[model samples]
Target: MTRKIGTEEAIKRWNRFADAYAANHTELGDIHKEVFLNPAIFSLIDTVKNKRVLDAGCGEGYFSRLLAKAGAAVTAVDYSPRMIDIAKERTPDDLPIEYRHGNCEDLNMLEDKSFDLIISNMVMQDLADYEKAFQEMHRLLTDRGCFIFSILHPCFITPESGWEKSKDGKKLHWNVDQYFYEGTYEQKLGERENMLFFHRTLTSYMNTLMKTGFMLEGIIEPKPSEEMLKKYPSFEEDFRCPDFIVFKLKKR
Candidate 1:
């Protein structure tokens, strides 16, 4: 049986792996973000100039810094204290950003209807209670405010899914199983640490957002653009399957 882990345990693992994680991230947030997520996310949203933005689960705060540079009044939140510290260190003193240590599931420190837009880059899957996090995002947004987020494609990146390589280690098809299993699972992040992630079905995610009073605006199964493939030739393999999904929702 897979051992159940709570939010506290998850945060502890994030704290331990914070430095290693931050080491790989730049202003664009690692290679994956640069190749896939950033394009998808930026394509969905309007101008950030003078917009009040919240970066939920702002790991290392690269996205927050990007928002600030793009002329948004950005507030970044991360549950890991070490991660917040690293984010602060990376951020230049000139970039006006508020780095707060808070969990996405419970952000009472931020008032209701406080933000015009909230972008949670690759965050929802890490939380133990994503439903509550969605509710909190809803509460934080002004009327008709936009909430954009990205996560590993729940249908493809489940606990029982991976590559099925050949004998000579040639790439083969991706395998997916146990799609209905929704709970905590251990996933190795780097060479040493195994991070905790909660899994949910695609239907569960959609239904939860609908129940939280969010109007689904758009969805993107990120595929590397031709420009990205030219820079990172290895990303051509992404054509075989989507590794991530982005969603744009609005509070109604």
Candidate 2:
């Protein structure tokens, strides 16, 4: 459990990033592509030809639109009104897509067993109640429906332990002192606004999904492409840490 961030505060924090978030990805272009193709998300999209899909934490609806373009009937949902607005704008009007404003913890507004596939990227750490969210996911999925998601890898990404390492000796290093302690981590994006996340153990995460009735399918940790490495000088060093993890689970 963690300190609860009210819906209002959560909404406000994401609103700050809404306008620039897509542009940031656009700016990162190849960099963004590399991250998306990262291990976690890749293994889950085996075949998305014609399925009902939901982008659960669709920050900007980028993946949601991608799935729709790939022939899936897609619905993208986000708690932030600002995010939903941006998602709607980016989505093509002709696509069979819906952008809804809703929290992950309670998908009560949506019909049960309505989705065939669900995808969420970088959403786990942002949630205030993962259990409730997982339960909703289970309820929303039809029998054997697939739920795929990604998050910051708990094993490697610990804050302030230093996001830096050396070329020799310890291939992996961390600040043990800072690693164990947990608190509200705030990244000051502006004078009045900030980015937030919650940190938890890997075991905690696996258990939650299992209890919610998902059979863990796979876990992936991706590396940058050689071409990307040649272009970005710091890619090798900066990407040593597993930045993200994807989980594929079948609803049972």
Candidate 3:
């Protein structure tokens, strides 16, 4: 069994992998982000025009740039200083984005009830203490504000889940195991880098969200659109099982 590491160690690994990770991200983010996450996230969000938006785990700042381009006053935060630097380098001077280095688990520098919308795309599962992150997101939102986030589907993307291949190396049905296990595990991200991820059951996620004062508004298991299919034919296999899940939650 792999030993569990905390959020700081995870961020340190991210810092080391930042350059290679950022290399994969374009203005629309990587292929997975473009094909799966962006559409679902945008569909769940309200108009960003003139809104005070927080890209809670902004990554390389692609989504933050999108929000800013759509007229949002965006404040983007990332746990890794390298990621913050990369995000700043990528962002244009005219874009309404302020990149900050901060962990999602506790964002004390940000004032309470200051944001109109908070989006953490594909970020929740990466942090060690997502419950505290959820609470911090709740604290950062206005009374009527909403929070949107995406993660590997807790039901399907467990620590011991992947495709079961055939004898001839053909992909078969997906496999899932260790669904109830909750802690840090290493997953390969690059040739030399293993990223830490936290696993939680779907029930745990929902319960924690509720406990953190969020009202579940909507959920989406995104599939590739026709346009996306035309761009990447291999994504057709993704229809068989969901690899990601997006949630839209409102402050109660």
Candidate 4:
């Protein structure tokens, strides 16, 4: 049986790996974000100008900065103190953003229905209590407000999923297993540090959103655009299978 990790352990691992994780992120985020998530996320939302935006689980706050630059009033929050500090330091003096230390499961500091839109990039999987996080997000958004998040594709990125590589180290088919297992699992993020991620099936995610009173707006299995593929040819491998999934939900 896979041992279930608590939220505190998850946060501790995040705090420890925060610096190394942030190192890979630029203003556009890592290669995966640059190629897949950003496009899918931005496509779902309309204009951000003069909107109230919440960057839930906003790591180093790159997306928050982007939203601020685009004329949104941005409030960014992260569970890790180190991440919050890095976000503040990385944020320029001009971009108006509020950085808060808080967990996505319970953001009581921010009032209910306080946001026009909430964007959580590559964050949901890292959370241990995703159901609570969903409820919190529902509470945070105004009526008709949107909540957009990206996570690892639940069906494909399972605990026992990886490449079935050949002996010569040549490319091979992607393998997936244990799709029904839903709990915390440690995944290597850096050379030594292992990060915790909670895996739930796609049905669970969809049903949870419905139960939380979020109307399903849209879903995207992010694929690198032609422009992105031109810039990063290696991402052509993404055509074989999707690595990420983005969802747009409206608070109803």
Model 1, 78: alpha-carbon shift in Å?
A: 0.3
lDDT of 4 by residue, 1-252 (tens): 255677888899899888998999999988898889888999998999999999999999989998999999999999999999999999999999999999999899999999999999988988888999999999999999999999999999999899998999977999999899999787888776788889999999999999999998899999988999899999999999999999999999
Candidate 4: residue 97 lDDT (0-100):
98
C-alpha positional error of residue 70 in candidate 2 after TM-score superposition, expressed in Å: 0.6
The per-residue C-alpha lDDT of model 1 at residue 127 equals: 95
Per-model TM-score on C-alpha atoms: 0.98, 0.86, 0.98, 0.98
RMSD of each: 0.9, 3.5, 0.9, 0.9
lDDT tens string, model 3, 150-232? 99998898889899999999998999998888888889997777889988888988999999889999999999999999999
* C-alpha lDDT of residue 59 in model 1: 91
Candidate 4: list runs displaced more than 4 Å.
Answer: none
* TM-score of structure candidate 1: 0.98
Candidate 4 overall Cα lDDT vs. reference? 0.92
Off by over 4 Å in 3: 1-3
Worst 10 residues of 2 by lDDT: 27-36
